[model samples]
Target: MTDVKPSCLEGIDANGTDSESAVERTGAKPAEMVRFTATPEKNGATVESENASQLDQATLMATRPNGGWKAWLQVACGFSLMFNTYGLINTFGIYQNYYTEQFRFDPSRASLIGGLQSFLLFFANGAAGPLYDAGYTRLLVVTGTILIVFGTMMQSLCTEYWQFILAESLCIGFGGGLTSFLSPTVLSTYFTTLYPLAQGIAASGAGVGGIILPIVYRELEPKIGFPWTVRVIGFILLATLLLPVLFLQPRMIPGAGRKFIDKTAFTDWPFVVFLCGNFIYLLGAFTPFFYVEVYAVQNKIASADLGFYIISTMNAASAIGRILPNFVSSYIGPFNMLLLSSISTFVFAFAFEGAHNVASLIVVSAFYGGVTGLFFALQPVVVIGLCPDPKLIGTRVGIALGFISFAVLASNPIAGAIQSRGGFVGVWLWAGVTTAVGTGVMSVSRLMKTKSNFFMKV
Candidate 1:
């Protein structure tokens, strides 16, 4: 259309070809206008209109959103990937049930195991952003699959707490983090204004996985034992994601080449505020992901099935939470969407404090999970809003997430310690307060971006 290809993948690929490649044909003279009888139809024309509709079809294709067959296929790949990684990760409650019984570890100590896994997942993704920008998607995806497969295989042999620390916490954490960061970047690079929708679609994979994996593990564990049950899930991930990598393209303009994001991009004020706010909000957000179900079991109000369901339900709700708000956001603005989600999260945390039964607990899990799910889906939009350069996007998000992972690292142990001393109310109240603090920080961060201006697009 513009004689320029899309820059969806911010960093360009080095080996791509265009008309310029004809110069190296090693002929004495190069033809100025190459033509052939066997040439395929130009990209945009519909068959019915033939030559007459070529320009019009080109314009329509140019204006199409990034949800082409390839892009959505990538989203499906993410769904399969996330289902395996997140489903297993959220099943910490399932693991925790036996972990305590088998190892005699206290809740506080066990929280560290789950906490460390989550910390690596989020924090390591900070680095993953840059690696992805350096043209590493295929590599990371393959590596992640290998790590997850090997980790699952090795985990079946574990007998001690530290074994999980090595196999599950570190291996799975690094594995998922690698895919997690790249998956979003891949979705965003292709989808322009429709990024939030695409991202919501991709992010929903984890939610589906979270919902299905717990049920799968729960049903299968009793019959097959933990080792084989876990190993079987590993193969499923390999099966689903292995083929799609071939169809995917980086979407960079032809002839453009890959380059790392500049460090100067990180110094922007809006990005800095985003970093801080995300750290505050996410630190509190991750606590429930890792431990809310464990709280249900510890409080003696619900059975172990309910504990597993807490996260499972939360994950299910999160899928909706991530995708549903996108339509409203197209009108209201993503920042507004984020602000409302943050406030609702704070409210949900407090609501959690009064819960004592399955119904109340389910509501808390669903609502809170939904609120946080929105945060993840749109937070990247906030980053892109602040800094629009594709080459620089990775740096800004990487740095922001790196800081956020610190809070992720610390949130659960804090929750576990509080639960130890004062039970669910104490931990939930702290979590609620943290959410409010995060909301306030995120709002202020936005204000800083707009020179104290509100209702600005970012």
Candidate 2:
């Protein structure tokens, strides 16, 4: 057999040779050939056409490393980003509790700051997705790092409600949003079979960071003072975020011409209903993270110091939850795993209402965190699975997260308002009911996709 060059056309090449002869000699099928045309520019240089770039992506997608040093490195970068983004967000309960005690702010009003910050932390993804798809991974990460560091520093100097809102809510929220979702989107390009597992590993960084930051804040704020403690956090953000800014890589073509709202995604009933369930669940999800410490302290279930660690405990279990369930999901299917996780979360939401002692609260926190961790890890996997075009995953994920931003933004404040009139029981009951409804809605999506087969891997 002769070595033959695969060709898009069967006629003569630029070299005036027979293209069909080249194809026949190598026995290369038409589908296996690299598809592109080279056109000469005015400078007598040859440039591959846009079709070449598209073909390059398809080729890379099929052959991309599922796991290797390079691929796993992105996971590490993702972990670091999550450590800074959701890690800190998970610790917001500490801030809420602190502001309530020190400043005497209304829980409902103070929650607005956290609500705004959380809002942009996800909402920014709408714009960030298109930017990531355009190959601005480094730019987005670096800019987000700068803003996060700046916001932390600014938050140190803040003494007023509006000032905290400006620095923490606007600056940090937008900054973190730009970086937070990009890791999963990037990982989707590198891993196929191991996508969920890789995402879980990366997302666990939030759990680890969540566990540590609360301890740092609790221990340091008393000794170093609030401003200096916040500054310490700023320095940590600067250090950790530098890794992704330095080395994170996007594996797709620079421009796929995606829109922020994929109108097509909304038309798919399964996708629409699934997002609605996610929306309702999110409305209750972070409410616990923002209030567990406060609940423990106010109810005298634990000392203030011990109460703070409940957040850490939840996050530790959450780290385990993020990793193990996702590993299991690789075999069972992400949608199936999501349904199970949703049911568990719904159960835990109600279980919190029954806990009246220190031990019971801690147990509830652990179980709740673990289940929510699974939900967070599964988000990207489910979105990618639903997406018809792999190239549009980022955009579709961004749109889905836009719904989440509102859910989180309104969740805490609503909980706070509910707590003001009725107490934590009202909050707990609301969380449980919403999660239950969300679970039921999500079941609809699963059933629709699996053709109502209860045991399908779907």
Candidate 3:
């Protein structure tokens, strides 16, 4: 720690006196303590070392797993809490069609609602991080569950486009933002090695929600109406939120919070780069998800039995996508999976955009949904690398996800505008190119953080 000294060997004055005392105390030879001499200008300072092995113990506990029933239970809580907020939003296409048809907005205008929903969901990420640090997990979860449940319940009353946007898009987006922050942070806390796996499993809840809701909505909405369909979904989330409150333990480090940044950390070049990458990724992400059902309808594959079943199919594939890449991510690192996920984005953005009919749209949905899930899965992991302190993980995630919200708010409407101009072709082209650009940004992230390509980490 000093320029003048090499650190360990310090001079002791009359060291033989100390050595003799030590030898007499232990009944050992008189030379048991070593003799040392120091010359002037070659002077050394006295140093002391304590053998308290327990001082840094909490740091290890905070990052590494305690590895038992309690931790896994917390993981399960994370699964329930996360799976709904992140996963259920995948069912967006079904709701998209419903909102558009009901509100009678033009396609470009209708698409903005989807963008707004996406924005609210991610925007919540930024606010909840600081709140979680200040307020703790219990307060956030309680507040989030109430907000989400009330938001969904309110969706039934949406009679116009603005009404739907206000109730479903903005309120639910706020709800999602509150709920999303808890998942990876909870899991990463207790099971660093197993975090990706936990994250994968937890995120699958969204997939499950996506699959179940569309089918349920398609069948039940005609019978009971849109208001009730959303009410049921709210009820389900209410149940999901309970398990975490009853069982999940914090494992929070004593006095650890808000440590990742100085006031200038937001201005730090690395975080700015990650934010840009996330923004672009999110910008390209929602077009396919928001449009798949419409694409199906336009292509003449309508069915009472299966009109919105495409959302379910995509959700199923995405369920696996979330789990698999996460398992792979543990060994290869999060950035590698993220890079591959981004490439998958370009593939689907271009491929699905061209689908003027049923089969092509389905192909696009399945492929795009899978990668979307992968991107969702990896974003949390990638953000964690930017800030190492456990206390600050929530904030880092919030910032990354907040940018994603901004991107989501803009991307779909942009794609919609393009579609309005030249039909689906121009829009899909824009989607493809947007994804390709996002991929480039992520490649830069890999370079700055670890200086490796997606494959080399393997």
Q: Judged by TM-score, which candidate is best? A: 2
Please, what are the lDDT tens digits per residue for candidate 2 over residues 1-458?
Answer: 11111111112233334534444644654334433244433222222233444344434344345787878998999999999999988777788878888988887788778888889999998888766655566678888999999999999999998989989999999999988998788887777668889999999999999988878888899898999999998899899988887767755555545565678987988888899999988888777877788799888999977887887899999999999988777677777888889899979999999999988999999999999898899887787677655556678778888777889878877887798898999888888888989899999987776667787765
Give residue 124's lDDT in candidate 1 (0 to 100).
Answer: 74
C-alpha lDDT score of every prediction, in listed order: 0.66, 0.79, 0.65
For model 2, the run of ten residues with the poorest summed lDDT: 1-10
Off by over 4 Å in 1: 1-65, 253-262, 298-300
Error of 1 at 18 (Å): 23
State the lDDT at 170 in candidate 2: 97
- RMSD for all candidates, in order, please: 8.4, 7.8, 11.9
Against the hidden reference, what TM-scores do the models get?
A: 0.81, 0.87, 0.80
Instruction: Give candidate 2 misplaced runs (Cα > 4 Å).
Output: 1-56
Looking at candidate 3, the ten consecutive residues that score lowest on lDDT are 1-10
The candidate maximizing lDDT is 2
Q: Write the per-residue lDDT of candidate 1 for residues 125-180, one digit (tens) a residue.
A: 77766665555556667777788778878888888888988998899888877766
As for lDDT, the candidate ahead, 2 or 3, is 2
Q: What clash count does candidate 1 reach?
A: 1
Which candidate, 1 or 2, would have the higher TM-score against the true structure?
2
